[model samples]
Target: MNKFDAIVIGAGQAGVPLAKKLAAAGWKTALIEKRAIGGTCINDGCTPTKTMIASARMAYMAGRSDELGIHIPEYRVDFKAIMDRKSTIVKQFREGATKGLEETKNLTVIYGTARFVDPHTLYVDKNDGSFENYTAKKIFINTGCTPFIPDIDGLKEIPYLTSTTLLEIKEVPEHLLIIGAGYIGLEFAQLFRRLGSQVTIVEKSNRLMPKEDDDICTVMSDIFDQDGIRVWTETQVESLSLKLGKVHVKLDGGGKGPASLNCSHVLVASGRTPQTAALGLENTGVVCDEKGFIKVNKRLQTAEQHIYALGDVKGGPAFTHISYNDHLVITENLLNGRHKDISKRMIPYCMFTDPQLGRVGMNESQAKEAGIDYLVASIPMKNVARAIESAETRGLMKAIIDKKSRRILGAAIIGEQGGEIMTVLQMAMMGKITADEIRSGIFAHPLYSESLNNLFMSV
Candidate 1:
């Protein structure tokens, strides 16, 4: 029998940091993971995806060498080499995580599947069919999530791909049909399209990135159209059939009859679901929602008071950074007696399409829904010197300000470096910095960050 002051299940982004914090605080901690450490972000999701996106961006730039007055030469994408680089990055991060955990004196890193035997007891199952029992004073669940595979007809029978499997492809598909137009879908669409694949996106929602502001979605739609990626909005996949090395999709919208599209490959970027089914929550007092996500309070404490849940398992924002923030908040509450609620944090989101889209705090629609008196100002990318110099001036930057308080209520950017630019806005919103302050701040000339200055100037 093994016992510890805290037991963390799944050593991913959230679990790894929390385990370290608890152990460093002199708590006896056991970090258990069935797979590699550093979770999806380090191993598969964010790191690898972004690495591949970088390669794809380079490929895009090479194709447009004429704009930069570069010599003309034909280039081919080595998909296998790109995957190799991504793999290398994943491996390096994994090793760093392992070494960090191994050096912690008060922490035990266990590689096994952990299942709840009781509210405070768990059984770890090893691959060799061996089992070990563990009891803890507290437990933290950060198992994260998995791709949600819909049960479309013949989807499983065909060689369908998800984000996890798509990264393993050594050769680019001749034609790729993607279902869903959220972040995942758009990202893969841009990557594969730049890699010389004909990409088509079918989104059930009426707009791309339905969670974002509609104006941003409109800009993204235009960019996709200009890039030759076919986008079908408000379309539902009725069924899928495989024939002659091609995928045939039946889609329906409005009262129109079913329309069909053919493609050499199909990728499902629908969404992800919390990975809680195998944890045997029924054996413990922990409660999960209908979708199998563990329920947690403002402090991330589960129904079992001694247990805490974070990241995607808590059914909140499912981003890698969000999971890291979850670790920070929970660690503070558990170790320092500080009461930090996850909801109180300023959360930002981004979609990495051609003209990236990013937002922080209440958007214009949300301000209206909340009945807040707000003023909005927008600046076109063409007016930004940096955007013009970079020849990527095809988006907009918008700011929402509280009319009474003059505080920045929200800011959205849809242009080059939108994700990076949103960080400045996130800090401002978090610190309650007003729009007038932002306007007074001097910005570097010929930089995309200056768009914020321009946006406030428009106000």
Candidate 2:
């Protein structure tokens, strides 16, 4: 039995950093993982997906060279090269994470599946088929969630892909049929479509980004339509089968009596489910919600106060940044004796579509649903001089402001460099910068940042 001051199961975004912090603070820490370090973000989620999104963007731009007044006769997309580059980036990130963990003194890296023998004690089934036991004064679970494979009749018998496996295709699929219309599915739809594949998206909900305001959804839906991406909302994927070399899917709902699609590939991007059942949570006082997310307090402590759960496993807003913030929250409370609650933090997220959807705080609908008095301001990309000059005029910038406090409430920027521009607004919200101050702020000319000045003028 190995005894340590801290045990972090799953060297993910939260676990790795927390382990490093604990070690640096002069505590013996054990960081355990069943797979590669760097978790989903570096290995499969953000890094690889964003690298491929960059390649897809290049493919999209090169194909539009003529529109940009750059004469290009022909250009080709090397699907293999794109995947290779993505793999290269992922490898570098993974290596860096491994090195970081190795350099941390007093931290032990263990490769195995970990199960709670009790609250403070865990049994690790090593990859080498050896068994080991460790007990720590404090334990943290950062085992992030995995893609939830939905049970549609006959779906499993045929070869289908999830978001992770789809990123690995060496060849651009002829026709790509996606199972969901959420962020992951939408990004992949645009990515593969721009990479020269015909794409179709099906959503059980009535609109794109069901959580967004109708107006925002309308704009994005229009953009997707113009891009020639077929969408079927209010639809249910009834079943699936293999026909010849292609996959066939049967669909229902959507007001159409019956619909079916035959595509070279099918991607299931419905959602993700937390990884907990394997951890043997049943053995500990640590309680998980009905949905399997570890129930944590504002400080991220489990029912067993000495144990904490972070990142996707804790369930709300499964962004890598959120997980990193979770590390901060835990480290602050543990080492500094300061409580930094996760609930009050501002979160910004981006969808890597061509006209990226960058969002921070609440939108109009959210504020309205909460019965908060809010005012909104918006402008089209075509009105922005930079967007017009760049010929990437396809989206809008919207800001929602609080009517009572006169502060910036929330913002959604869906245009070229939307995420970058949205960060400026995010910082404003973070600092409690007022709407009037943002409106009067001077910005450099003919840039996306300049649009910020115009976007806030209305409210």
Candidate 3:
């Protein structure tokens, strides 16, 4: 039996940081991962998807060279080269994470699947078929999540692809059918469409990205229609089957009859579920909701006081940065004996589409739902000099402020560099800065971030 001061299960964004902090604070820490280091963000989810999106965006711009007053003879996408570059990026980040762990003298990295043998004991199943027992004072569960594939008939038999397997393919599909209209689905739809694939998206919701603002969804739907990506809203997928190397999907709608779509390949970009099944939570006192997510308090502590849950497992937003913040709160509570709750932090989320969408704090609808008096201000991208100069003058910047206190309630941006510009709004919301402070701030000339200044000025 091996004993440690802390045991971190899963080496994803949350676990890695927590382990490093504990180890650096002079604790004997043991980090366990069933797969590679850096977790899903570096391996299968964010990093790889963003890299592929960059390649797709470049290809799309090349197709519009005529608009830029540059005549290109011909442009061809070397799919293999793009895949190679993405692989290189993932490998580099993975190696860097591994090296960081190795440098931590007080941290021991274990590559295996860890299950709770008891409240304080963990049984590790090593890749080499050997087993080891570890005991620790506290544990952090950061196993993250996996793509949720629906239980459609014949889906398992078909040679369908997911975000995980699709990233590894060197050849592009002739026709790709995406099964969801959330961020993941829309992102891959745009990417494959730009890569010359006839893409069709089927969403059961009334609109794409239903979680986002209605106006933003309408604008993005228009952009998607202009890009030749077919979107079917309020359409239910009844069945999926393979017919002569092509996948056939049957759909049903409220006012319409049954419809079918035949495609060369199908990609499931539906959302993900928390990866908590194999951790053996039953052995511990920790309780999970019906959806298999760990139930935790605002401080992220599970039913077992010493065992904390973070990231997707704790539910709510599943962004990488949120997981990192979870690590900060947990470390502060453990090391500095500070009392900071996870809910107190301002969480911002972004969808990296062509006209990226970002939101922080409460929006107009949310504020009204909460029965709070709020004021709204909006600025179009065309009004910004930088957006006009970039020749990508589309989308809008919207701000929601508390009418009583003049505090920035929430802000949403959908335009060029909207993702980058959201950081400032997030800072204002988190720091509890007022609208006047933002309005008085001087912004640099001819930059997209200037939209923030213009937004508050109008308010």
- CA lDDT of every candidate: 0.88, 0.91, 0.89
Q: After superposition, how far is residue 226 of candidate 1 from its true place, in Å?
A: 1.0
Predicted model with the maximum TM-score: 2
By lDDT, the best candidate is 2
lDDT of 2 by residue, 238-348 (tens): 998888988888999657678888989889999999999899999999888898999999889999999999999988999999999999998998899996898788989
The CA lDDT at 95 in model 3 is 95
Cα lDDT tens digits for candidate 3, 102-202? 99879999999999988889999997889999999998899999999988877888988888999988799899999899888888999989989999998
lDDT score for residue 372 of model 3: 89
Tell me the lDDT of candidate 2. 0.91
**Residue-by-residue lDDT tens digits, candidate 1, 230-342:** 99888888888887878888888756657998898899989899999999899988898999999888889998989999888889778888999999998788778998987
- The weakest ten consecutive residues by lDDT in model 1 span 249-258
Clashing pairs in 1: none
lDDT of 3 at 249: 89
On a 0 to 100 scale, what is the lDDT of residue 375 in model 2? 92
Error of 2 at 200 (Å): 0.9
Residue-level error in angstroms, candidate 3, position 438: 3.2
Report the poorest 10 consecutive residues by lDDT, candidate 3. Answer: 450-459
Quote each prediction's TM-score. Answer: 0.97, 0.98, 0.97
Off by over 4 Å in 1: none
Show the colliding residue pairs in model 2.
Answer: none
